[model samples]
Target chain A: MVKAIDIPFGPQHPALEEPINFTFEVEEERVVDVKIRLGYIHRGIEKLAENRTYHQNVYLVERICGICSFAHTTCYTQAVEELLGVDIPERAKYIRTIFCEMERIQNHYLWLGFTAKAMGFETLFMYTWRDREAMLEVLEMISGKRVNYGMNTIGGVRRDITGKMVERMEERLNYLEERANYYKKVCTKERSILKRTVGVGMLEPSDALNLCAVGPTLRASGIPQDVRADEPYAAYGEIPFRVVTYDGCDVASRILVRIDEIIESVKMIRRALDGMPQGPIRVKVPKNVPKGEAVSLVEAPRGEDLHYLRSDGSDRPARLKVRAPTLANLPSLRKMLKGVNIADIPIVIAGIDPCLACMERVILVDTKSKKGQAWSGEELWRYANEWYRES
Target chain B: MAALNLNRIRRRLKGRVQEVFVQRERRIFIRVAEEDLRETVKTLIRLDGFNHLATITGVDIGPAIELIYHIIYKDAVVSLKVQVPKESPVLPTITDLIPGAVFYEREIQDLLGVKFEGNSSSSLFILPDGWPDGVHPLRKEWTLGRISKKVRRLW
Candidate 1:
């Protein structure tokens, strides 16, 4: 019998984009157990939001997650708007929906690239990222920023999507749709991707529901639970789109769900653009929100993003809570990591599209010797690649 | 549709809930005593079909800390609000019923100094290891100045 070893995989590792640590207990090749430690990148944003005024908190909340900035801002603004008892104009709602879908497309592409790179498919990574640039360019053109598009405000969006911008966005959307189809073909036909991802990191449907896995992860496990379809916030009530789901309950199904959702996002954006109503984008809201509390849910690219706000009849919020999708998906991630080979760690971690920062180092501790070895995330990536090649 | 769910939940949890506030179409907030949180959650999950626990939010409300377990039922957010006095900010763990709540509970424990009675893992979840004990940042007393002053000594 081989002795078990503890591999501390990140608060800073190459495979992890964020500073979250996962301690894996390994016996030979299989992982016996897992423990997760988070808050390495805790910015105290919720506490900060309490100090900032309701208007200023929009920008503060947007900084919570770089990729889902709009989702954060939207949720924040929606909660505050509810507190103020304001309904945004129909045009503003359409604009919010368009940006939400645009963000989803770019985010899924980013995840696809990173997951491909994690699986040692460098070419696919480069290609997906290249196609992702078109979506980013359109976002930059509309919001004047790539990642954190501060488009949302208390009553409505900050900027309006003009006719010229709409035309350019349409052109970009067509290109993205074509690229998405091609990538779908590649993801389905490629033998290496199939071998690497298929039947890997399974989270059963019951386990997923009990664990409260959200976004693509839950949908991939055969659950059709989606906030957009369920709650219909923003303009999702007016827009028609499918909540994509797959029953494979593995890494490959997650890949398929994301890819299919990107196509759905593309369709949603096109429809929003075509059917967008004309009206004032921004409305006047009171200086201070009343003494009320509200909860807002947005279907962020990764999963369900929830924000809660309470006012004390003051300029600032009494309290604010932001639950990013990554936090919701962490438990399911723990469930997925169990019983998998050590070599499959990177792919499984990348499969969730965790919204975090870069890693610097990793520590591997042998339980028997009580000795430790420090390694970089790149080292682990290389080790996984070599192990797969040898096997 | 949302009102129907609200009425069903109101009728089911009639005696348990202190106040049921329908903030909007799909948002329902129910205030319950600390002891009834587990049973209330059980009812929501088992009978009401509010299986998805979106998150748990804790706010330091002057004399008491407000703990809101935001559970998703269909399209609505049924937030179960329970307040525990600041002196003894302890509550039962819902992790047994919904295992995903362990992280959120630990987060509240770390930041607000709330204790989950039956939670197994007591070590810090979100805060850094060296973060000073009893310095719950989310509490109203731990203002920006106080936090910086307390956290600054560590460096």
Candidate 2:
């Protein structure tokens, strides 16, 4: 008896911070399949990035996602710099690293806030954002702006963090650590938190890698592959840190993975500040680049980010390819959704922290009945679902 | 320094490897002619551990269009670029071998106007409504009237 029940949710859901819609095909309250369609906020950022010069594209890419804006710009700039063969300064590396960690602090807390909101715990969501403000204030002190830092360039950073600023950051980190530890306990160990997350959306490691998964989603599945540690870029190879991984492969596992990384991020900032080498913040970058290709990978708050750049001495890139973590991890939705309760879909999807600007998909499924459709390797094989080939 | 799992397949019966690049610190790039792209993709993706299609990059050279299919397995990244004339850009889709390439292939088509043979939908992505026919913004010839002139403003 194969009964098909369908349900459509989103483009406007409390669980999603961006505009995204997903359909779940449920079999008696348990989701057997899902069709995720999210093209609601397709802003054409990639085409825009191509139109701008190498230097200007940094600012444009930063605006891709407000949560992890710095990481996007840094990855873009680093790739361009490599293509141009320009080396950044030592102090600038440390400063950039510090800012990246600051972005991480904000992104993780924002996820926690969204997680709280998804579970109907508005008070916890309010508290998480309240604590998040401290991180934002510190970021403003360093960058002189809140959202788009405008700190990164092709060769180096725009400014430096004075010793006084470092001391202030130290104080802020102390307070934040105390509050973050408390929130971790309340959110991960509390009775209600565990009931909502534990054992929900469990995924195995082999299944995750098969789906080309990344970020906390892959980490939660016990794969010790943090782009920072495995293929270190910037000052990550020089710094000391651990890749946080959990073997549980469930929603709870994702929460614990990000929470511990938040704690480690604090340590990275402190190390960068204390051991920062003195040097110029900016390097002189030539307008024309040599003809060559370079690839760069970095660990964003979500997962691994890949950039491929080739230059032909032109103002713009001859060949540019960017692989955001959100896109890489989308394939794992099927693995995570199988056998899970229909009500728990939001939590499982949120575990990956997807950035929708890079992902534009269609959301068309039965809006009610909550039944998921079976999507095998065949559905994906239909090919180029987005572009037309005129025969 | 680390190990990778890859199932390497040579070019099609009529195709040959145009370029083979082994990167120093990051990944590998495989360059094949346009005709053999289908065979190259099918063989590499079925490798015991190389089931994932990392990404697809489009390079506009003004005179000709280039498509680079990036494949990742374990820790190694390999790319295969197929160069096509700008006049009529079209290539077969590899979504059959690795389903993950669907979005990436779509993105290349949307940006470069290179059609993926046997794709599901044929539409523009990120192109403004009522755009001109046969105009791909990423192509080098799609000159920016005033946008390119802003090069001096960054200084």
Candidate 3:
């Protein structure tokens, strides 16, 4: 007889970077059902955005997720700029495109490292992160910051990619391309990696659509949809690149999709560098934005990052709504988690690159007692650890 | 083809909605009657190929709570807005059609006090546990001062 047991994975688990509590119902080695509890990191960024000026919210949104900080700022700034009806300069558009692709390189490397680390391939994790540092160095050279570039402003990019900076970025890109190719080979041919990820977490293309999966997660499931390709923004319309898709529709496919995307991002960045125009990077705009609602969508590393800003002819946004890719991809996570081994839970969750920081929001009330139970960080960690050992 | 798709969608829900128009480039806005919302959404998803429900954003617009369901179709985004009186904010859930909307609907229910009629899972997905009941933070009346005051009193 199979004895079913309830296992709480985390409010604070060793696997999760952010606090996402998952209570897994397991029978022997297979997961029967999974209940996810979020909100541990809910800072109410959307509500907070309503209180800050449009200019101030760029920095605020940039902090929503560390790995995709540049994506958030770009989306927010683009929405505000749309509201202002100011045309961004050609040079600025190319500069924004460069930063966006550079961000993709850094974010994909970070996810690759984290996923490898989750799967206990510590060597691969270290190597990927080491190469990731080279990408960050290039970002820091251009944006003056390693993490949140602060490159985006209302009208255009804040800084120009000087010729010297372009040369440095090119040097880094060549190194990154070589490393990416090596990683791709290891991902495709490595026996241990193939055994773990090949047929695991299989998601059909139709399932991906029903669950509204975005970015690489959706693309891996035999869908060629990408925001940059579908809806061209910045310099994407002018630049040349192909949307990468795989028919494998499994964890291995997801890994391969991102690896190929890194190659494509390198090509796009090189295109932006070669054809970059010369002009002022920014245009002066008024403090108060016109009364309108603007929707901006950018293909972030994980998925499509969307921002909806409603301005009431004031400096501050009347209402700001952020729909991060992770939120859209959570249902897909739940779908993938079902029937997987308890140990594979970490890689499956990390595969989605779940950014709970960006997905977190506000309000809770327990229906049974009319009062919710708040678990301390230490208590939740203990609960997660105890379940892992027992199950 | 994109224009025809939008036109077909607009045609299907033209009479059921209060107003509908292209808000901007690649954005179509439709303000629907509260009763006709679920039907309109079903038509869009089932018939119009608007498979992706990008997100459901709830805003406190003074008198009424406005819930906008941003649906993705190819390159365009169709935002279906439905307004409910703040006194009794309730709307039918679309989770049955688009499973991805469960989280967004729950978020609206938690933060804005807009009750999703058929959304089964009520355990708070967004806010931390022990938050005060009947006090929706996203409501306009629940200003920063009032919210802090309410939290202080609740504890």
Ranking by TM-score: 1, 3, 2
In candidate 3, which residue ranges exceed 4 Å CA deviation? A358-391, B47-49, B153-155
Clashing pairs in 1: A12-A359, A12-A360, A13-A359, A14-A377, A17-A357, A18-A356, A18-A357
What DockQ does each listed candidate score? 0.73, 0.23, 0.65
Candidate closest to the true structure, highest DockQ? 1
- Cα RMSD for candidates in order: 11.4, 12.0, 10.3
Across A1-391, the per-residue lDDT of candidate 2 in tens digits comes to 6697888877685257576666778888898887665456766556566655676577668777777778888888888887776789988888888898888888898898888777677898899899889899998998877667889988999988998988899999988788788887886668988898898888788778666687888999998877787666788868899899999888888888888888989999899888899989988787666778877777889988877888777877665667788878877876788788877888878877767763212323455976655555446434323221221
TM-score of every candidate's chain A = 0.90, 0.88, 0.90
Cα lDDT of model 1 by residue, B1-155, tens digit: 34337678878787898999988787889999998988888888865445589999999989999999999887578888999999999898999999999789989999999999898465898888898989999999999999999888988
Q: How accurate is candidate 3 locally (lDDT)?
A: 0.85
lDDT of 1 by residue, A287-335 (tens): 6899999999999999999998889999899999989998899899999
Task: Return whichever of 1 and 3 wins on lDDT.
Answer: 1
Better of 1 and 2 by lDDT: 1
Cα deviation at A33, candidate 3, in Å, is 0.8
Top candidate on lDDT is 1
| Model 2, docking class | incorrect
- Between prediction 1 and prediction 2, the one with superior DockQ is 1
Q: Local error of candidate 1 at A296, Å?
A: 0.3
